[model samples]
Target: MVVKSEFEKLGLPTISVELGEVELEKEITENQKETLLKNLQDLGFDLLDDKKSKTIEKIKNLIVDLVHHKNSELKINLSDYLASNLNQDYNTLSNLFSEIENTTIEKYFISQKIEKVKELLIYNELSLSEIADLLNYSNVAHLSNQFKKITGFTPTSFKQSKDKTRIQIENL
Candidate 1:
């Protein structure tokens, strides 16, 4: 929404907006493209003009949303969800993501999940069991195992650590 607002602020007559793509009422010139990029950058956003980069960003955004924003566990597998959402094949998407990120899509998704667990753990409002349930973990042990694997700290230890800071979403 804020990204779309930025486009409208530029008086370009925004047409549509999505995770990796944006459309304007008319085509843009080189200078206009530069200006738009600059504007988005100023707001900590980027205008991806390439398919690969855009697809990567789209994947990241979707994972972030699923892990952080969604209220329930996904009914479909991640591969199916991503392919259906992006209208791309799972194998192609997985290959591209792995090649560019040097990490599998599953690993990136797990990282996102770990980050969310860190946030929930730090808040202290929810019990570990509650947090596990909220994040759709099958069990606290499973969540704790994955959390320890990623962060080298169990959920309890993470909460106890002085440096409980989380990675920024853009960094992920």
Candidate 2:
């Protein structure tokens, strides 16, 4: 009842609402759902449908998985891998991602990789060369160049800076 009332206040036409202890399920027709989503977007909120949001979430998970499990020795090409796994063409995914996120997927991927590099650097467990190898960079030089370009500091300098900060993965 409360949920339905709230939807009504938003000028939304609710079909049904189910309240659960841990989750809420709202059954809305496609047109009504799209209308509500458009309203949210007009209010400066992103309205990603289940399919689109799930695709983005899967991409995020894949990045994390590659970082944690693959350690940057990612064998599969990103476009081919994403397309095959998500059952969508890379171009479509890329376009949708850019339209929604306001950034290219490749940039997001690079940012995540740089974050992992920061993590490894903070641990002080691996040499720069080793870190490069672990992250699948061609060499320390390439990693240093990319790191400097992304963070505006050399890897060594970044490691030494007392206030080096990295954005959280989820926040990115």
The most accurate candidate by TM-score is 1
Q: What is the lDDT of residue 65 in candidate 2?
A: 72
lDDT, candidate 2, at 56: 78
Residue-level lDDT of model 2, residues 1-172, one tens digit each, is: 6545546865665455542111224556777667756765665444444677767767776766776568744656878877887788999999988887899888888888899899999999999998888888888999999999999999999999998798887788
Q: On residues 1-172, what C-alpha lDDT tens digit does candidate 1 reach at each position?
A: 9888877877778778876678789988898889889989998888888889989988988888888887574544899889988999999999999998899999999898888888988888999998888877789999999999988998998899899989997887
Candidate 1 TM-score to native: 0.90
Model 2 segments beyond 4 Å from truth? 1-49
Give the alpha-carbon lDDT of every model.
0.86, 0.76
47, model 2: CA deviation in Å? 10
Off by over 4 Å in 1: 18-20
